[model samples]
Target: MTLRRLPDLTWEDVGALDLDRTVAILPVGATEAHGPHLPLDTDVTIAAAMAEAGGRRLSAHGLEAVLLDALQYTPAAFAASFPGTISIGGATLAALLTDLAASVQRAGIPTLAIANAHFDPTHLRALHTAVSAINAGGVLRAVFPDVTRRPWGGRLTAEFRSGACHAGQYEGSIVLARSPERVRGEVMRELDDNPVSLSAAIAEGAQDFVAAGGPQAYFGSPAAATAEEGHATIETLGDILSEAVIDALGTETWPRTKEQT
Candidate 1:
């Protein structure tokens, strides 16, 4: 079996898949503020690439998986103040995911896997809530490895924990890894480091980017980001993603057997 992209494949191609063993990966992202240097689709790019890597990992592990289109509009409460940052309401985001999950199940896909990159509190809550709703409906819930947790989180870079990684070294590095041209060299060189803990500010009732002490809508060492570190970060993210798929496959509830009454 090949690692296919759901959108690129024809209906006949999808029909040929072994539904019992196949899984659909749904990459989720938010078109939010990513500081001055990064684009609006930064989250989307990261999530989509990670999802593809995860799909490849599942294929390597002897299962079939495909990457689906990413959900771009997610809750962006923090970045919503910034111009060009588009955000959907939390409830709306949840409604969309719930509908997508149901749509996938009806297509005969055995299971739906969610791949995400955005770390906004509201965004995370919406994704989980949507998944919970789907799971409650008796549909096979997707595997969402909390990258913010141990093991996987530990696998990520140090800047991630500092909470100043928004468009900083952590994100900048991986963005460079994925697309070097997108990174502005002059901006990176001139930008001073802001090592403030965004989490701390948020704990103190900081809501938006400015309230978080980031007037420029950024934090951490953007200038220090290197392509080498970016590649390494991408690799680690891929490991986290693929591992989730493998682990989820072991516990899939697809082709659910009828309970013996």
Candidate 2:
């Protein structure tokens, strides 16, 4: 059967799909400053692209998957001091997530996965809380955060550690890869220093990275970012996410409890 994108699918069409077999992917991102070089919508753009790629792959495998509209407005506590940054409080973000998950459950989609591109603490907490609620409600079987888990997580994590993960090389590369025109290469050259190291601070549950000594509200070497690396990262992340979705669909526990549905 030909797969239908969620945006294109009518309410009747969604209602017709086997609810038990359908999967919904929600792309979660934040509107935050990524230095002067990148657009404020970087997170949403990347998350949406990744989710679309994953949905296509799942559909190719005969499992139905659709990309939901992104949850773009989110917590940007780290970049709160920066202009053009739009962030919400933790409680607000959690409420949004909970409502979205509940809507998906009511729509009859058995599996729901949130594809997150931003790493804000508040955003993470909200997402986790939503997943917990969905799981408790017995409407969702599995929820995969950071779709990089199964196949390419190790590689991505390694790259992230190698000065590519932060707003520097890795994120810049993705922005360039997804939309070269949106990147300001010259501006990136000026903010080339690593912002702050979170290895120690994160353990203590700090909210803002800038407050922890990352003055520029960025990290890693922006000069090192390349369109090639961005493309490679996206492709790798997409592959891993696809495999994860397929695996989740194949599991018996997925869409775990049928009592509520």
Q: TM-score: which candidate is best?
A: 1
Candidate 1's C-alpha lDDT? 0.80
Ten-residue region with minimum lDDT total, candidate 1: 252-261
Instruction: Please provide, for model 1 over 1-261, each residue's C-alpha lDDT reduced to its tens digit, 9 standing for 90 to 100.
Output: 568888899998888888777889888888877778887888887887788777776676556787788989888889988988888888999999888888888878867888788888888888889878987887565778777666678778889887777888988887888887887768877899999888678778888888888888888999998889987777777778877766666645333224311
Clashing pairs in 2: 141-255, 195-219
The residue pairs found clashing in candidate 1 are none
Each model's lDDT: 0.80, 0.73
2 in model 2: Cα distance from truth in Å? 5.3
Query: Candidate 1's error at 96, in angstroms?
Result: 0.5
Give me the runs in candidate 1 sitting further than 4 Å from their true place.
251-261
